[model samples]
Target: MTHRTQLNQAEEHLRRSRENLPVAAQLLYAVADLLVDAQPAEPVTNRVAGLAFTYAGLAVLAQYPQAVQDAALDRALAVVPEARPSETGGEWALRLRAAAGSVR
Candidate 1:
């Protein structure tokens, strides 16, 4: 599948995970692992990176272990800071910043 397709699937899993579904975290993690393992050929768009970061931040907010949250945020930052809101990022960027703030 294309990177976009994978990203979309990941986004869906993340949403379900946010709703406190027991199995959703596993699905989200699987998608995250797949994305990490299958590094994209071309750089992903800022929006896509921003979404990933937001998801990671959400996981942190949901009280996943500190190590897992840190790893997710670290990976997200490595790809794109996504630390603040921007024209390109909108709410996702804001959500990321909020998540980061809560972690501290």
Candidate 2:
């Protein structure tokens, strides 16, 4: 099953404000929770900033740990196109579900 959690706080934040970090932070938190629910074996953390471009989808930013840097970059750089959903609530969750599936 594809599970997508809508960060309404983030969406609300985006709508009322142009703050990126707060929104991105919520995005990151949602992603982390999604990953755990999706696959418990794999652990992902946002130790550094992350980047998700329209074409690139989602990519890890910031410095990576010594052992995982290259691999993380490789995985992050390979993401397909992605964007913030205009649809509120469940729509955003589905988008995240799709993105997670794409990652797999």
Candidate 3:
């Protein structure tokens, strides 16, 4: 499936999982929509930042404590996209995993 399709599916999953939490459900859907509709011509840094924010948003949907979610946010933001231009998506994902783990 296309990446956009995958994102839409993910959004649906998040919505289904958090349907009871109205505010979180809304936030999750909004984030997914933004990711799926992101401009291809946008700068790499912006895309990287979007991924970072999505990671933090997912942490919240996963029912992490506020402290852990904040830590994830901080760690994700600390990744300077411009400085890591050579890193692949998998590498950044690993970093995000480490960031979340570090707080636990």
Candidate 4:
């Protein structure tokens, strides 16, 4: 399957597992691992960052340890470009940053 397809499946799993924190966290971690392995390009990187941000937020909501949340946020931030030209990309990066701040 394509990376996009895999990412979509992982995201679907994450959403479906929301009521089960352990499952959701596992899926989120899987998604993060996929993103890391893919090493996606510009616009795709933006999407990956958004997914990571969501994972971090879910980690916080699920009462995960601070280190886990920080790691998720760090992975998200690490993928974001220092300068994204697309408005949507910039917006997603900003949202991720905001989510990171709130998680801490």
Task: Say which candidate scores most in TM-score.
Answer: 3
Question: What lDDT, from 0 to 1, does candidate 3 have?
Answer: 0.48
Candidate 4 has its poorest 10 consecutive residues by lDDT at 95-104
Candidate 4 wrongly placed segments (more than 4 Å): 1-14, 17-62, 89-104
- Model 3 lDDT, residue 84, Cα: 55
| Candidate 1 lDDT by residue in tens digits, 1-104 | 99999999998876675555322333234334333544433344555664653664564435667666556555534433332333333433344333433322
- lDDT digits (tens) for residues 52-101 of candidate 2: 22212233333335445444345433542243333333333345445544
RMSD of 2: 14.5
- Of the two candidates 1 and 3, the one with more favorable TM-score, higher being better, is 3
lDDT of 4 by residue, 1-67 (tens): 9999999999788566544443333434444444444443345455665665476566443566677
Q: Candidate 3: list runs displaced more than 4 Å.
A: 1-44, 51-83
Best by lDDT: 4
Candidate 2 Cα deviation (angstroms), residue 1: 25
- The order of the candidates by TM-score, greatest first, is 3, 4, 1, 2
Q: Which 10-residue window in model 2 sums to the lowest lDDT?
A: 48-57
**Which scores greater on lDDT, model 1 or model 3?**
3
How good is model 2 by TM-score? 0.27
Each model's lDDT: 0.46, 0.38, 0.48, 0.49
Q: Could you tell me the lDDT of residue 93 within candidate 4?
A: 43
User: What TM-score does each of the candidates earn?
Assistant: 0.28, 0.27, 0.34, 0.29
